[model samples]
Target: MAFRNGTDSWVVVMFFMIVVILFPLGVGPEPDILNKISSGVIWVAALLSAMLSMDRLFHVDYDDGSLELLVLHPQPLEFIVLAKVLAHWLTTGLPLIIVSPLLAIFLNMDISSYFVLIITLFLGTPTLSLIGSIGAALILGARRSGALLSLIILPLFIPVLIFGVSAVEASILGVSSKPQLLILGGLFLLSSALCPIASAASLRQAIE
Candidate 1:
């Protein structure tokens, strides 16, 4: 559904591009300053872009009654939620990953850090989707849900945000980014194992 709609993904991509554009203006034209902050800026923007779309994960389904039917079906809701998160990542995160090199160039990111940026995002963004699913599911039909959703999910994203930026920073410094990358991979695995179950439970509660 996210892929078919196209608008959500486009918004995320545009937001990321806009962030990249704005930072350069605010920080001046120096390659040194741009390069210095590139990874952190991009990672933060990516995280926010994902958050901006998080509420849509289950909102439409909930509004249209598809969510009720989905809950009552025999298939495990956790698996269904996992599939949804995967689709969300494909529609949203993958585009960000694909276009990030261009953004990196705009930010004057070091050539060496490119690999780690892609690596960290590959390991990190699906976890973003997974984690966002739980937050979205938790707040289904709640008042002012966007604001509440961020409150629930943003803090949860901190560990991921930290390690993601750290991995690219390590690469820029000519140090091994492997440790941070491994932690990100581990975070993905952990989220994969846990978030879907939590989302499923939240959905069940919301529908009941």
Candidate 2:
């Protein structure tokens, strides 16, 4: 599932490139300025791309009635939701992290920030997926679910965005990026604890 969704979602790579390239092009060609701004722009683009891809997380299975069957499975819905979330991370989140370094280069970021960017994305994107699943579950089967999902999700995403971009910013300045990553890790852990149950509840409500 992860492989399938990831391959299907590869167009997001194009979006990422456009964001990384066009911003500097529109602003100026200064590599120093580009590096300074690159991490935030790339991460933001990745976040939006992931959000765009998230609607398909359940929509495909739901449309095919597989979601209904999964609901009836012996294992708990929480586990099922976790699986889906993991698949979402593997497909959408991991690839973004993998490509972040090249994007970071284009942005003119220092090499040291490379570790920070990857770690931040690793800690952060899971929280995005978990939160996105909540929105996905909430709007399942509803009209304009794509737009509604973003409306429900974008607000919840602000903290992750702030901390994630901050971590990169800190890295660029040669300051310890640990605190920001720690906060992101804490957010990921909290979301991991609560998001599956929340998603399951939302799924129940939507299906009912």
RMSD of 1: 0.9
Q: CA lDDT, every prediction? A: 0.92, 0.84
Best candidate according to TM-score: 1
lDDT of 1 by residue, 1-208 (tens): 4345788889989998898789989989899989989999999999998999899999999999999999988999998898889889998999999999999999998778988899999999999999999999999989999999999999999999999999999988899999999999999999999999999999999999
lDDT of each residue in 83-149, candidate 2, tens digit only: 9999888877877778877777777777788888888888999999998998988888899888898
- Runs in model 1 lying further than 4 Å from the true structure: none
